[model samples]
Target: MSAPWLADAVVLAHLAFILFVMFGGLLVLRWPRLAWLHLPAAAWGVAVEWTGWICPLTPLENALRERAGQQAYGGDFVQHYIMPLIYPDGLTRHTQLVLGALVLLLNVTVYAALWRRRGGRRG
Candidate 1:
């Protein structure tokens, strides 16, 4: 595959992963086994945001862009792409912390509901 195509694929995959990390815990409600996959993913997502670490995908995408004869962009994937669409003001450390907290809050709420529905038992 060409570098441009590969870069686009990476961007799409990154978006999907973000969505999954943000909401995949809800899937555990229907498939208990999913918790094994989603719990760790959610934690990793939270950790990445809280620690202000750029995801590995960002560099891969940037490299792909360069290989495609395109200019490499600065900042993480969000700043280069998602931020332009949703957060015109740009991303900041505070925003990253908020994103981390949001991830934690949403997952906790979903897991709490799951726990309550499961008779307060650990699943």
Candidate 2:
């Protein structure tokens, strides 16, 4: 595939992963086994936001863009692509912290419910 197309694919995958990180707990509500995957992904997502660490996908996508001879943008994927859509004011440290907290809150709530549903079994 062309570099640009590959870049686009990476962007889509990044977005999907972000969505999964944020809401995958809901999926786990139905498929309990998914927590094995979702927990680590969610932790990594929250860590990225809290620590202001750029996700590896961001660099991969940027490299693909550069390879396509496109003018690669500065900043991480969430700042360049997502922040504009959600927070037009741009991403700040405070914003990142809030986002991290929100992700943790959502996942914790969902997982708690899952735990309850499973009768709080230890296995």
Candidate 3:
């Protein structure tokens, strides 16, 4: 209801979505049948970072915060909250790219392992 509370809610939701996008592949690895859901989400996450497109949720959350009279944060929510805990100074573009690459690499590795296990079962 209040500005700060609304902003906090937005920040929390944004963080949850980021976590889901980053780790959802692990879930898919456990249940390979969910590739249909996880693959698209993973692709979208990668595409958003590669293209420098602001996630729709970011803008919507900011708008809501602004309407609530809270100061809207500029960068991605990860940069605002998560990065500070790990990196003292701040997040740079290079760091963001590295993080994105790590997510992509992790998902790729999981998918490959799953494929091998499935193939072995068939063999």
lDDT of each: 0.91, 0.95, 0.78
Query: Cα deviation in Å at residue 31, candidate 3?
Result: 1.8
The positional error of residue 32 in candidate 2, measured at the CA in angstroms, is 0.3
TM-score for each candidate, following the candidate numbering = 0.94, 0.97, 0.82
Put the candidates in lDDT order, highest first: 2, 1, 3
Across 1-123, the per-residue lDDT of candidate 1 in tens digits comes to 999999999999999999999989888889878999999999989999889888999999999999999988888877778778878999989988998999999999999998889899556
- Clash counts per candidate, in order, are 0, 0, 0
Residue pairs whose backbone atoms clash in candidate 1: none
Which stretches in model 1 have alpha-carbon errors above 4 Å?
none
Sorted by TM-score, highest first, which candidate order results? Answer: 2, 1, 3
Q: Compare candidates 1 and 2 on lDDT and give the better one.
A: 2
Total backbone clashes of candidate 1, pairs 3 or more residues apart or in separate chains: 0
How well is each residue in 1-123 modelled by candidate 3, as lDDT tens digits? 876576678778877767767887788778878888888877877777766667777777788878877778887766767889999788887777777788799889888888887785563
Report lDDT (Cα) of residue 75, candidate 1: 84
Assess candidate 1 and give its lDDT. 0.91
Alpha-carbon lDDT of model 3: 0.78
Worst 10 residues of 1 by lDDT: 77-86
